[model samples]
Target: MTAVAAGSYPTAPGYNVNVRSGPGTQYRVVRTLPRGARVTINCQKPGQAVTGPYGTTNIWDNIGVGEYVSDAYVRTGSDGYVTGRCG
Candidate 1:
């Protein structure tokens, strides 16, 4: 996995996005990010596809160490590497 630069992602309005232990919904929910919360995307990886306010995608984003949220629920202004890949 390639390392991407750090970037910001805004959660959907009026919804708390799930931060899972893994990249997919099948994984346990680790925490929740409040609506409109701007988070720092640490990395990204392929995982179970999900539909969020933005759209449907299998792209999952790493928000914290061992924590992730679906890209679909996050609004990243631009698409590309946001930070270095997780080890």
Candidate 2:
């Protein structure tokens, strides 16, 4: 996992977000994050655009190996990438 000094971002309140194996929803869901969960974004990559509590975006945050969550569901205080792009 990549280390990001930006800290962690919170998931949309009251919603349990899905963590996919890839950057997009087309990928298999590896797990579901509980509501009010906070995640540290290791890296980000372009993926399927999704509209969530935060807004619409195509950015996906990699929280763990093979685990990604839509940026639209994460409150990162920015509508842009908060960390380095995934290699």
Candidate 3:
């Protein structure tokens, strides 16, 4: 299947989501995205499963080098992976 283009997606409307060092919450919090922040997904990886405003998923979106946010919090339209899988 074709992957969604790398594009900016919004985080859950009113929550400041955590950006982790890896693809899971087990990783350190690298940063925190402010409420209403938008992030351009560079890639994705399967990691810790998370339940958020959208739904439960193990998908983590790479927003930057060493930065990942749960796909559960990003509105990518699809419930599945939107971008290419991170190598």
The lDDT per prediction is 0.80, 0.94, 0.94
What are the per-residue Cα lDDT tens digits for candidate 3 across 55-81?
Answer: 999999999999999999999999898
Error of 2 at 76 (Å): 0.1
TM-score of each: 0.82, 0.93, 0.93
Candidate 1 or 2, higher lDDT? 2
Deviation from truth (RMSD, Å), model 1: 3.9
**Where does candidate 1 stray beyond 4 Å?**
1-5, 78-87
Tens-place lDDT per residue, model 2, 30-52, is: 99999999999999999999999
Per-residue lDDT tens digits of candidate 1, residues 1-87?
996557776788889888999978899998888767988887789889898777888888888888999888888754444555666
Candidate 1: count of backbone clashes, pairs at least 3 residues apart or interchain: 5
User: Runs in model 3 with CA error above 4 Å?
Assistant: 1-5
Task: Give the clashing pairs for model 1.
Answer: 3-84, 4-83, 4-84, 5-82, 5-83
Instruction: Name model 2 segments beyond 4 Å from true.
Output: 1-6
RMSD of each: 3.9, 3.0, 3.1
Deviation (Å) of 50 in candidate 3: 0.3
